[model samples]
Target: MPRRFWGIRRLLRMPVTEAGDQYSIWVGLIYIFNLIVGTGALTLPAAFARAGWGLSTISLVFLAFMSFMNATYVIETMACANAVYKWKRIQSIKRDSVQDHDDHESDEPSRPFNDMEEPLVCGASIPSRYYSLDRRVELGEMANLFLNKTGRTMFYCTLCVYLYGDLSIYSAAVAKSVMDVVCSTIPANMTNVTDWDALPCFNSSSADPEAYTRMGCYRVALVTFAAAIGPFVFFNVQKTKYLQLFTTGMRWLAFTIMISIAIHLLIGSGAQSRPPAFDITGTPTLFGACVYSFMCHHSLPGLISPIRGKSRLGLHIALDYALISVFYLLLAFTGAFAFAHLNDLYTLNFIPTDNDNLFVKIIEYFLTLFPVFTLSTSYPIIAITLRNNLQSLFLDMTRLESYNFFLRKLLFPVVAVAPPLIVTYFLEDIGILIEFTGSYAGTGIQYLIPTFLVLCARRYCTTLLGLGVVNQYKSPFSNIAWAVFVLLWSFICVVLVSVNIIQKKS
Candidate 1:
């Protein structure tokens, strides 16, 4: 409010187009927070148990920072895309100046502007209204704008792979959760029921035809899950407002109850098992899981576009990452130390025991079915996304009218749903699925895509708008060296994960 503070205010504030309905920056922050914290968080405690708490903590913090940096890269590219759009609009107006001279007064060279408001071309200031992060340019559009044919194909390939893996993980996790809740009895000792034990879901001495091994029960649940949820793939469905609210509430409430229960256990049992400080055997899986945990770059544009004020957006995002990192540490640490044996699916740890009271049993049952409630809602959305992208890869957009109804609709959805469903039958290990998915496809989305997007955007912006203009939302790691570091890091992660997989197989 003072003259001296005007510079500070200007530096901190960026104004988008005056749309009265736009949400506040705080809403955008919450959207991002929700986006980053998803199914990946469920796998973290198991990753911690394997990797050791010391290594998990250090790796998670570093990965969160890397993820934050790339998220800023995504935002910076969005602004650059908007700037390119503005430049093209100006060019189009300039070409029509003779016929619409009076209406195009804003394009007149006589207008005055500050140095920061004009772009330099050949050392000359080209005056125009400043661009803002108002336009919603999705990642696919950005790929088209900045990348060539090969790069776009690679982008879609990696994206579709990640989505397929996502659906597979969702399928297995939900089925596993259901199997545990339905098949598992309240054992006298809670730690006795291992995930892969050969125990039958029904009594071994029973004469019932429905009796089956635990693994068979899991397969049955997987089939049942597909039968119930797979039809949504055939029909278009969206996550409604209430559905989102329900899932978000369930997620946080479950996490709260889990951490509370874990703390209670620690206090009661005096730490059942002391976890190691570091373990190399778990690092590969931990790397993949952490990469998956911080994944929100692909969806950043949709979340960040509607904020009315984007001033200090980078700082706001940094704050979100800070809070998320701390929350992750808290969750993983509490779970790592509480139980002698942690389940790959953290929710399994809360399965009710024969000794627990009625209220505790109810809570434990709720926790055990948590994945079913949440991932069940998510499965169709992801399947539909993968279907659309798979169609995009195979079908030509220009000839959509020529394609048949079955080709357009039925084929892609079946292609999307069937493979992941089939995979769930063979690969019952959710952790291994997570490790493969997050290590390969997750790395591409989280690290390499953002790295290349920023590089191409910077080069294109310099050529289109010249060097005088700055991307206000540019990443703090805006140097070639950082790009190189990210690339190298991705390569090393792939190598390590691959070696780990090979070792396990041999």
Candidate 2:
């Protein structure tokens, strides 16, 4: 085995061999689907309404295409990292054991997910080294290996900031959703539900309607959200297969219900017959929203690495992304025409808190509070990710193991969870915050990092494995052209968003 094979393994502290566990293609796709289609989708209709149906659709489709392209790059980069191992052990290791392991995993049931474990070593003395489908390479590790300290620092900061924003958005959305539905009961008159910014309705009976405002309820929910989910940040969250399945099921049901209701409303008199054809002012927000909505970049490694079988892996990812694109298109478009004024969170459209129909009221409550069902399951996982990144940023890697475990763990969770909760208290609006978060940090992570990762990996492979070696896991857009374009696009979006923010303030 070549010394280069052990280079990334030592640097990232990852196992050089497989754990004999891999996810089926369907499971992989489902993970990708569930991650992308969350609170982000809830804002699509409003984005479409402002950006215009046509522009919003085009932007979303374009962004989805970009996201998919970047996903391939991430996949290719992971393979390249594994390729270092492959290159190191290529001379000494043989293929018989690897083939047998693949065959064994193929025969296993696909219903329940498999746990990641140490690589199963069998026949060969040096162990079979191959960059097969189930190889795991986390993004942070990739940044460290392929990038300079400066580059790695940039990545860590961008990722942590975006994730903090993400947690904040999730916290606020669930709290607000619960507050909206719980506070507003069946109003005496449902004929005139306006899109006015009203404070939380706090009056119990007819005594004092102005006693409590919506903001006040949101404050309470925000505190409760922190209390319930904030603690999960301190612990390590592994694959909760059942919890994920439960959340994924509820997500599909809620989304399907929203879409069904939207279509029905559009077909009826509730349709916005003359929504703008092209809303130029709305394009920036739409861009941010779409990027936010399509974001699975930070989590792509987790989704792709554990999947079994790599026969035409690129096509599988492409197909998965295409399906998601169509799904988002259908969802955003339906929501656009269904109502005259859509909430930034499209779920709000379905929650007719004061509707006359009993069935409608039931659904309103269901859709309104649906985030609690889904985001609650995800909050801890994301917070943990953010927490880990903060650890990476602050502590020296060499000294990490020697650091005080209690302080190291406790400090990050508090740093990660507390600030976001505090920020959300003052900055109550989810829409504006999501814009800055996605337009800046989201763009860099989803677009810029993948490009650089691939470039660096390519350079590393060419230097180590030589130009003659073929990287089987290479991206279709594996050229400098795509990478350059992504970099430019990311920079342009950031500038545009900044300018827009300034103008709005002025």
Candidate 3:
């Protein structure tokens, strides 16, 4: 065999997981599906209406492909990080062996879930390397390993911004959904209401006129939401198995109700509705919404870390994307055809009408409040993730033990949860939040960061582990040109989104 193929053959002999390192593959898939299909999916129908069906379909398909490719890049870099760590460990063991003058030290077998089948002898020829994905290496730690000081700073900044945007969108959506559902006097018949703010929270309020506006209700709802969900950030909470199951169940129920109802409406009279084929002006917001809809790169590590077997991880993720993409298409198409005017949040389209049957009305309320249920479950987890990252960015891990509990635990969570909530206080528009978050910071998280990590990891791994080592989990799109392409795509998206925002204002 040629020298180039030798490492791959050796690497193929190892197992992807050990006996007790992670959970079953099915659970991992559920968590990923839940994370990827959240508030972003809720906004897709409105984006679809604005951009038109044909153009939206093409853009969505392409964006999903790019998102999946970036996901693979992150996975590949995780394996590289593992490889680097393992190599350093082995070298440390070798030096220790020399100091102790023990010949038997180098003869020990490699541990499971570590680098597989590493050379046992000191001063021997470097063998082909195979990095396992059994252990979880986070994107931040990967950045520390593969990126310089400036690169690490930029990575954390981009990640923090995207996560803050995520929390902001979640906060605003949940509050708006709750306020809309709970307020009876906000006009049940929304046909004549051009602006959401035009409706008053109550029929009559002479005590304080400003307090009667919908904006006041929204602020109250926002505060109530914060009071209810904010405490979860201060504690350590994991997404347990039952929580995943429950979230998945609620998500499916909500989607079924929305799609079935829309289909029924379309069959009756909505078939005559004519939507635009293509609208260039709407494409900028559409681009942002599509990118937002497919965002899972930032949370991939935690979700992918617990899978028991990962030899076919890429295949499994592809299937998840396929299912999600199909479901998104169904929801968007049904919605765009079923209603002449779509709400920014698609769930709001299902608000109960006065004439609705009792059972139908209950279902309508449930669908309308779907964002609250789904986003409520997610907000704490994202807040906690951001809090931990903030600590990593600010606190020195070497002196972590010296810090008091208040500074270490309480401050970061408050820091993470406060900014976005404050942001909601000033701006409650979900469309603007999604557009800026998904288009700018989201572009960096999804495209540029992953590209840079993989490129750096590949270089660092090759230098450390020798040229013959191979990473089994390497992305199929492994060419340097792919990295270049992703970078170029990110640049172009940022430029276009910025230009569109400017034109809209002018």
Measured by TM-score, the strongest candidate is 3
Residue 108, candidate 2: Cα error in Å is 39
**TM per candidate:** 0.77, 0.77, 0.83
Between candidates 1 and 3, the one scoring higher on lDDT is 3
Indicate the TM-score of model 2: 0.77
Q: Write the per-residue lDDT of candidate 1 for residues 440-475, one digit (tens) a residue.
A: 888898999999998999999888876766666778
Best-fitting candidate, measured by lDDT? 3
- Residue 1 accuracy (lDDT) in model 2: 29
lDDT of 2 at 340: 77
Q: Give the alpha carbon lDDT tens digit for every residue of 1-506 in model 2.
A: 22223343342344433545555767667766667777777777787888787887778878888888998898888888777655555433324434544666545333211121223222333222334434455677678778998999898888887888888888888887777776755345532324212433644554544447566677888899888767666765435445667778888788788888788887776677456879898876677677777888777765566666666777877787788778787888887887777777777666564468898787777887788877886777677667665665666543567889775777888988888888888767766777778788888889988999889988987787555555567788977888888888888788767876776688
Q: Candidate 2: which stretches are off by over 4 Å?
A: 1-22, 85-135, 184-201, 205-220, 226-238, 310-312, 391-415, 425-432
Report lDDT (CA) for all predictions: 0.75, 0.71, 0.79
Q: Which regions of candidate 1 fall more than 4 Å away from where they truly are?
A: 1-22, 99-131, 184-239, 373-433
Clashing pairs in 2: 2-88, 18-119, 42-346, 199-214, 200-213, 200-214
